[model samples]
Target: MNICVFLSAADLDERYTRPARALGELIGRGGHTLVWGGSDTGLMKVVADGAHETGGRLVGISVEFLRGFARTGADELVVATDLAERKALLLARSDAVLVLAGGLGTLDEVTEILELRKHGLHDKPVVLLNTAGFYDGLTQQLRRMEAEGFLPVPLDTLVHVADEPADALAYLERLPTAPQVR
Candidate 1:
């Protein structure tokens, strides 16, 4: 399966580096493809490196302008014209999506995926790796959105929250083949 991971481009602190590497190794050992942003910095580099260490295939999608800073680890590189195109290609090519601990960019990507799901565009599984409760606040906010009727559907129907990388991998492993996003 091709698992798309949304993560920070910023360097990971010790808190996240270990698990990020583990997640990458898990994907590699399982023979799953790692799909992600094509940057060479931060968690992006870590995950790609970890996966590559185990001989896993990596697919990176990035805006054309970022190619100069893109990493060289990806086995396949896809250049998109803009952010919108990058997001579209990321969603379209993945069997499942993993949300790792990150900053604003990660939030934006996850929200976009949820928005897509809300519109009945896809039914693919989306899991949030809430390492060390990193996403607890966001999860609460999502619950609040649902409670306030701001969301079109229940939040759980759109994303799954996991506290560990192994757990997220388990969830992904259990998912059926991804359906085509409309």
Candidate 2:
């Protein structure tokens, strides 16, 4: 499967470093393709490196302006004209989306996917890796939204949460046989 990973462009928090690395390695060893922002920095670089080390196929999508920062090891590099295009291409190509611990930019990517799913834009599985409680606040806020009747559907119908990389893969493996509730 082609897995899209949304993560911090910079490793601002140390807690996520190891998980990011492990996730990348897991993706590679599992023979999954990685679709990500075309940059070799932060958690992005760590994941890319880990995947590359295990011979995982890497497909990077980014704006032409960021070409210099692109990961040299990517098997296929695509430079979109802009961020919107990048996101669109990423979403269209990925079989599933895995969100790792990240900052504002990561939050933006996560929201983009979640909002689209909420509207029935896509049925792809969206998994959030809640490492070290990185997404605790956001998860709470989402549940709060469902509780307050602001969300038209239950939060569980929109996204899945995994505590680790292995759990995330397990969720994906279960996706096919799992009943569709949406």
Candidate 2 TM-score, true structure as reference = 0.93
Clashes of 1: 0
Question: What overall lDDT, based on C-alpha atoms, would model 2 receive against the true structure?
Answer: 0.87
Clashing pairs in 2: none
Native-vs-model 1 lDDT?
0.88
In model 2, the runs with Cα more than 4 Å from the true position are 177-182
Residue 78 of model 1 has an lDDT of 95
lDDT of each: 0.88, 0.87
